[model samples]
Target: MSITLVLVVVMAVLYAAGVYQMLERSLTRILIGFLLVGNATNILILLMAGRSGLAPFVTDDGRSYEQIAEEMADPLPQALILTAIVITFGVSAFLLAMIYRRWRLANADQVENDETDASVREDAAGISAQTTADDRALDVLLESSDEGTAAKHGESAMTDDRKEDR
Candidate 1:
């Protein structure tokens, strides 16, 4: 098989596995997913760069500048991929640290859904009455405050000035 086809297949597999792992609740699995995705992205960049050629630097040979430019590989994609690798490494390190701290505090590798999320789901499913009550209370409070403020301030000095200008 051709190298491009092989790389494409590998990239596809990496992306598939990465997305699947990312959907899991475990931090380790998420990290693995990130790594897989990063590798897949690098491969994609390489594939898009087309066939490799000579290095992109000045040479002592007698080749013309235009010839050198034509023969040299495109540097931008390689540079972008290198920068992406460094950024990914830094972010991965930070995530690993955060995961370690979370593990230390919670003593668990799997993340549990937050109570707020559970409450939202319960509200959505019409299984919790408190949600509606809380929302109504907040709406009433906001309406009262708006009316009180409007009555107290009438109109701001800025609005009066703008009206005079018009």
Candidate 2:
């Protein structure tokens, strides 16, 4: 098969794996997904440049320029990829730091199962309810002189609270 075709297939597989890993709840899988995407992007750049040829430095009778320019592999993509890799590395490090914090808080590397999910859901619901109730009371107190205004303010506050929760 052609190199371009092979590279395309590889990039597709990497993208799929990255998506799957990102969907996982564990932070580690998400970081790995990001890494896979970074490498795949680099490979795509390489494929775009086509196959490498002999260095363009040497000339007839073995003459060469001391400050050869075009002889190197397309240095632009390589330079771009190098910068991307560094940025990816920094992002990965930050992700690791966040994961470490989560682990410290939960004392586990793996994400907890249904019980944890349920508790988080319940806590979120309770917080939502409390915030809504508080907003309603505030709306009544602040707009108590006008019935229509109080109702509108209460409705707006609940909508704002929902958006904040999201």
| lDDT by residue (tens digit), candidate 2, 1-166 | 9867888999989988988898887789988998898888888877777557556545565545544444545657667878888998999999899889988998866766799889999999999999999999998786555645657677543456756886
Query: What would the TM-scores of all predictions be?
Result: 0.73, 0.55
Q: How many residue pairs clash in each candidate?
A: 0, 0
lDDT score of model 1? 0.89
Candidate 1 on 49-152: residue-level lDDT in tens?
A: 98899989978799789989888999999998999899889989998998999899999899898999998897777845767888999988986786677778
